[model samples]
Target: MKLFECQNCGQPLYFENTVCESCGHRLGYIPDMNTVSALEPEGDQWRALASSGQLYRFCQNAELDACNWLIPSDHTETHCAACRHNRTIPNLADAENMARYRKLEMAKHHLFYTMIKLKLPLKNRIDDPQGGLAFDFLSDQVDANGNVTTVLTGHDEGLITINVAEADDAEREKRRTQMGEPYRTLLGHFRHEIGHYFWDKIVRDCGEEALEKCRAVFGDEREDYGQALQRHYNTGAPPDWQNNFVSTYATAHPWEDFAETWAHYLHIVDTLETARSFGIKVRPRIKLGHELEAQVDFDPHKANNIDELIENWLPLTYAVNALNRSMGQPDFYPFILSPAVIAKLGYMHELTH
Candidate 1:
């Protein structure tokens, strides 16, 4: 999520930019280099100007406009690092499906960007067919009896399934309101689900010591997940849930608590990195001493401790929330961070490192 610019023209660029607007040069992301670079067409291949003249080809999914990542031309693999993990994509023949799939890819690619930045383990189905990470984008099915079965977004083993409908802003907003969620987005969904994937890989499989530490912070994930969710829906979160949990839904189960907290951990670090990229420093005119002042001058991903991140995050949230209100919009971040929640986030920080 760091800022990128067109190497050819020095024009500002974005994560999804496929072509530099100012210089008219084609663009492709070099995953290993972790940068979006200007490209020069070289017969059937491309020369990455920012990658020491390395020759490459677009990921196979690029033909569908579903990916703009690159692959070395000499490499046998056709897909880029991120798209290679997709086990299933919606039927591209359907125009709506194609559009929705594109939206999903944009979010998924952003998730991978952070994953790569964090050096998290990534094993596509090809790498570990039995338990490697993968994705499935599915559509709702309607029966002849006029019954519609909605596809639920979730993760099982190493496969993450997402309902294509979530890509539609209207449907997503409706679900957010119905579920009483203050914030929800395609990127949030990816981060939350991937949290489950990592819990399996890093916590569950690591060892007894790791499991014990996780249990101490996130509670015993061995609790009955199905029963916990059923009870949660029936009675709802406890009145003082915010004192111990990040969200009402997080109160459903220990596993959920971890996932919800993990997602927020990603939210804080990534947004802080973005703030640093812009050299954002908040110093309100009516400052209450240094409590409200912050300067994102360090790499959030490599922060020495969770407390450091929280200190920097609070000021940014306060500043942005005010800016959002100025435009008559809801707060950019609408949740509070309690000491207990910060502890869980600390666990996530430790685990990622």
Candidate 2:
């Protein structure tokens, strides 16, 4: 993430900031422009400082104490662009549910930011006959009682389900340790699940030719998903899994391989954007159009194209990881992208262009 500032006072601001501390200006995120603008009340509602004619208000869910985004009241959609598609939220009667849901919402916003930056189309599941894109911030076994026995995170069709427990640092850390995953976070979960959503949107929707190519590159996705999942749980990943798959689970199915690669694509792009913000640069050796295209201008707030993105990222990640070692902290980036992974990333890059 890049730094933000108050439009009124030029004071430092954060993505989630509702009020600028230095200038005391009310702030709202404009999704259309991918900007957070300082605002002033116009009569009873809020208007952007740069465009006062556009009427806006904090999300009604915010009034109910659930969201922090702004929305146009005159618009037919009651929820903000981000919140409008929420299919299921945990019961807010329990205080913990609200906090967890808020955290999930924040992560979702970041996910949407990257998706929009890539010019990826986002349609809510409700808007699609097969349920295109939906969210389920759920109460899992870890968060809920009364005979509930459900896993915290999973994606099916277009619905991404997240266990509220994942929002709790301690609980998430414990799961991370148990799962032996090098990296995990709320944002990671969102990116990964959205990967699944996009695979369905892109690969599954594309015609037979694309499906054949995907199967040849990844694997056959026709395997029974439930059986493959059961087998993965029972027997664990294959011994030589690392040679072909981005993750152990990626070996379960071709669809998973696509999702894992998609998530990594987001990770690479976002991290590269952050790196460029800090003035990190890499010496370009080979000149591929796609590689050069990955270079992005470092905007501390808005998103940019994926080209020029990973160029700066490769170096910035190395420097940060070394810096972390100097401080006795774990490496900031712990995963290695093999040549095969790079090929998969290339496929994703093609999708973006």
Go through the candidates in order and give the C-alpha RMSD of each one to the true structure: 0.9, 4.4
What digit string (tens of lDDT, one per residue) describes model 1 on residues 1-353? 78899998899999899999999999999999989999999999999989885799999999999899999998999899999999888888999999999999999999999999999999999989988999999999999999999899999999999999999999999999999999999999999999999999999899999999998887898888999999999999999999999999999998898899999999998999999989999998884847889999999989999999999999999999999999999999999999999999998998999
lDDT of 2 at 29: 81
Candidate with the greatest lDDT versus the true structure: 1
For candidate 1, the per-residue lDDT at 69 reads 98
Backbone clashes in model 2: 10
lDDT of 2: 0.75
How does each model score on lDDT? 0.94, 0.75
lDDT per residue for candidate 2 within 287-306, as digits (tens), equals 65344233335552233433
Clashing pairs in 1: none
Please report, as a residue range, the 10-residue window in candidate 1 with the lowest summed lDDT: 283-292
TM-score of 2: 0.87
